[model samples]
Target: MKRVFWRAGLALVIALAFSSIIYGTSTLKNMQEQKKAIQQQIKKEYEELKAKKDEISLVYQEILKYDQQYFEVQQVLDVLETRLTEKKTEIETTQAQLVTAKEKEDVYYKNTKERIKVMYEYGNTEYIAVLLESSNAMDFYNRLEYLNKVVEYDKTMLRRLEDIREEIEETEGRLIIEKAEMEHTQAEALIRKNDIENIRVLKSQQIAAANKKKEFIESEIKERQREEALLDKKIEEHIAAIERERQKQNNNALKFKEGFLKWPLPGHYRITSPFEKREDPFTHKIAMHNGTDIGAPNGTPIYAAADGEVIYAAWMNGYGNTIMIDHGKNSSGQHVITLYAHCSSLVATKGAQVVGGQTVVAKVGSTGRSTGNHLHFGLKIGGAWVDPMKNTKK
Candidate 1:
């Protein structure tokens, strides 16, 4: 009876142990599922944030185009302003000429009236009288010439004064028309300048709004990251266990063989900024630059740095549209990692295998902490930031 009781007790304990084990497993699975759901939510939110950023970039590009047009309009306005000044001076000169001609016309008419009265009083037959007094043919010819000269002189003076008056009137009329045209041009230029100024103000407001939106989105992203970090730690721990078991079975460590890799970018690639101490664009403080900034036009293709596994491919804080590759081991037995940042779009997925100088991983962009379109390439030795130029070829 005693032996049978002891065996029954042992069986009960075993049953409880098995049930406890099953319960623990079920609880852990539920926890992992909850974490996974949160992670998925983070991913959804990140996507929305990036979409807003892209919109902002497009808005900035539009502003740039408008600025170019504004500059051209301003140049035309300058010319119009100058021409208007010239027209004003011309009008002044024309008015002065008109006044002088009017004065001369008055004098000419008054003098002519008096001279005509005198000629009438002195008898208008002077030419006939002089011809009748000639003694011979030669004398008659000389007296006739003198009379013709006096008559022609009076007629020529009147004709010259009349011509001068008509010319001044025509010049004044032309000047008035030109002045009106210049005033119209000046008005049009002012209108256009005002329009451009209004556009600039509007664009400035939009740009500020965009920056605010970015800041808000970035804050939210950071909060989400903080929450996700806890989950990530647990997930990494689980993955590390699996990796350790696999490495034990192989009797070897996970390592990559190192070699001189091909240059990731193609076709006359230039480093806009080098990996050195420089002033931070945002803070204006001196800081160390960890990577070389390769300048490129927006949408320029980006290739993988070497043959490696894509360890991370996503948008990260301060490193937008980032890709991180694990390229085996270096001479110091440290894991060689290369990072690419500020891409417009990504083609490679996480955990994807890629070949050096071949895979088109992303396109260059001005995504995060950047002033223009470019790629930020980084190197990490033993998980610490290192200069990529040491390993770069030309």
Candidate 2:
């Protein structure tokens, strides 16, 4: 009975040790899988942000064009106003001519009427009587000639008055049309002037807003640089400590691997700028791009790509609003570290164990050496910089 009990106890101890090994392996695998997922998410978010940044930039350019157009429209309005004034003066002159013509026409008509009436009355009486009562043929002939001349002169005057009246009516009709055209032109000019003014105001406001945004981006970059510096210092110390602990525990067999991790953000983000040996966008000089630029908008959410412990969650130099996570160990015993820079804000705290696909960072404005709002993602393997794109598959 004593032998049997001892054997049972030994078997139980062996079973427990095997179980522990299996559980530990499973936990490590889960963490690796989580990290890969987070990396992919980060990449997606970066792509989305980049596209949006481009769109916003285009809008800014369009606003500038609109300003120029507004100025041109204002000039056109001025020309229209001058033309309208000239039309009004011309209309006034035409109206005066019409009034003068009408007055002359009325006077001519009154004189013609009186002359015709006298001729008609005298023709039956005194004119004819004088002709008939003449003492000689010469006297009668003279009176008849005088009467004929008078009648001819009166008929000419009446025809002249009729012509003048027609002319006055035609002139008045033309003046009325001219006046209507002037009023219409004036009204159209007023509308255009008002539209130009409104457009100018709107364009001015847009320019001001763009200027303000530029200023804010500059300030943010400076602050992010300072924070990144501090965070880098902390990260270095933390990695060193972790290395020491791993060696002491003889767990150096497991380590982080480069080119095997995934993105940390969601969405497809284009790398407007990349991490490489290239010319700087602002400086126009050859400089090392320390991190990859993934353009995004302000307030876009950021996620973790893998399961890892937050080693440093703070700002660093040249990296605005940064976060650093330490993925424990890979096959080579080297530590894996992921850095997120130029974030708007940090959601996870240092020492917190974050799961893959979890929101750990916030999208923010460009914080370092950046022209716009974007996130700079960096991957460091065993304290050495590595290309983040190499690890991304999709």
Candidate 3:
């Protein structure tokens, strides 16, 4: 009976051990799943933020292009004005010519009227009487020739006057048409001028809007930078905690993954500036670039790299709209912090535990001291700034 009791006790112990092992395996699996989910969430959020930023940037650029077009229209209007003035001068000259032609026509008509009246009153009777009253045949013949010559001369004068009148009328008609054309041209020029003024006003409004957008974006960027810095601090602390925990556990097989991380945005966005100590674009002086700048449109969505708590989600001075997340320690005891700067808004909040590939952040904008829309991602290690790309997983 004692021997039987011993065997039963040993079996119970084996059963307990098996149960413990199963429990530990399940817990580890759950943690890994959670971590993966967090990473995915971070990536998703990063993409969304980038998209928002890109959109805003595009709008600003469009506004600038419109301004250029507005100036061009103004130039065209100026040319139109000059053309109208020249056309007015031409019209005036045409009017004068028309008047002169009318005067000449009036004179010709008057002379023709006088000749016709004289010829009508005298009729053919005068010619016949002059011929009969001749002293001899030779004289009569000579007198007839002189009478015919006078009638022929009068006919010639009448024909010349008629031709002059017709020519004058034609010229006046042509001048009238030219004057009408000039008036139309003048009207068109006036319309063009009005259009140009309208365009200028519209462009001015656009410029103002762009400036306002830029201001907002800049403010947001500064804020993001601060948030990122804060997040970095938190992440470092978390990493250190993880390291301590790992050391206590003494797990020698676990290792942290390492490589340059891919940019959160999908498009092949350009890096206007790199992570390093460099000169400022506007200041043109030596300054430290706390983060790498990735150019994109405004209102683009931002994402997190791994699972962690959001330490900040607010406006930072130079980072514009920003988001900072802290990823907990890996098996190897390393902590990770990711910062997103120059955002239009913050979708996530402080103390919120976010998952990876989630839309926890927004796009980078020209919020503070920025020339355009772009993301400034910063990483930190042990309360010190580190290259983000270097720590990112491949």
Candidate 4:
């Protein structure tokens, strides 16, 4: 009996240990699955954020295209309006001339009618009587000559009347054609006006929709800040290395033109945001803006700040399409570098030489963390980022 009880207890212990081991294995498997799911969720969120950014960029680009089209239409409308005004003036002048012509025609017609009536009343009897009463052959011949002159004058009056009638008909035909052309021009102008209005409405609607998605942008603020800092550090390191190498090579320093750096954007002087500490657009936190933001229409040409070699021309972490030009050392021996960011397209390639105020380096755009179309320009001198406005000239 004792042996039987001991065996039963051992069997119970074995069964309990097996159950515990199975439970532990199941819990471990569940934990691993949960971690994998969390990673996937994070990845999915990041992808969604990228997609939203791309969508905003495309929207801005579309709006820019519409803006250009609107400008072109406005020009056409102005020309049409001018033509219409000129045409109205021409028509008015023609109408006055027609009135004058008709008056002259009426007067001549009345005079010719009177002459015909008198001639008809006298008929050939007066002419024959005058010829018979002539004192000699010379006088009779003179009376016959006078009769012929009178008949010729009557024929001239008839011909003049026919010419006036033809003039009236021609004037009337020209008036009709002018009126038709004016109407056609009016129709064309109306179509252009309508097109401009439609584009304006679409652009306004798109802007409104974009504004409503501010929350989405706000979510990316923190991540973008971190990425920007990292990118800046990377740039600083690279520039420093370049300067060191340049210094090592005697007379190898890059050359730049004299005077202040050329303004990157022409016809775009409005500063959307200055290089000062201000509330961040995305985070609403006080942050230092390392660069100046110049508001401009998208696709506006961006020129090089100074003559320099293109060092970096590619997409950056938060700056989107970016360009960096090394303008060598200044008169003070401080290494000068210029940065242009958030470009829609890049014109200068890396390692290419560019001229200040002459080379078109890129096109203005709303890329990366931008809220609208503009340029974020940065100037680094002696390893420190400074306000670009201080060294730029329009």
Which candidate has the highest TM-score of all? 1
Rate residue 340 of model 2 by lDDT. 79
Off by over 4 Å in 2: 1-76, 120-126, 129-150, 206-214, 235-394
Per-residue alpha-carbon lDDT of candidate 1 for residues 160-270, written as tens digits (9 for 90 to 100): 877887887888788789878877877887787788778878877887887888788778778777877876786677566555534432331133333455566787478
Candidate 3 vs candidate 4: which has greater lDDT? 4
* Cα distance off (Å), candidate 3, residue 27: 20
* Lowest summed lDDT window (length 10), candidate 3: 248-257
Candidate 1 lDDT trough over 10 residues, lowest sum: 248-257
Which candidate model has the greater TM-score, 1 or 4? 1
Q: Write the per-residue lDDT of candidate 3 for residues 124-165, one digit (tens) a residue.
A: 676688899999999999998997787687677657656765
lDDT for 293 in candidate 2 is 75
Q: What TM-score do all the candidates reach, one by one?
A: 0.52, 0.41, 0.38, 0.42
Superposed Cα deviation of residue 160, candidate 2 (Å): 3.3
Q: Write the per-residue lDDT of candidate 4 for residues 208-230, one digit (tens) a residue.
A: 76655645555555455555555
Q: Which stretches of candidate 1 lie over 4 Å from their true place?
A: 1-20, 125-140, 234-394
- Per-residue CA lDDT of candidate 2, range 5-63, in tens? 22342343234323434554555555455545545554554555455456557666776
Please estimate how well model 4 matches the true structure, expressed as its whole-model Cα lDDT: 0.73
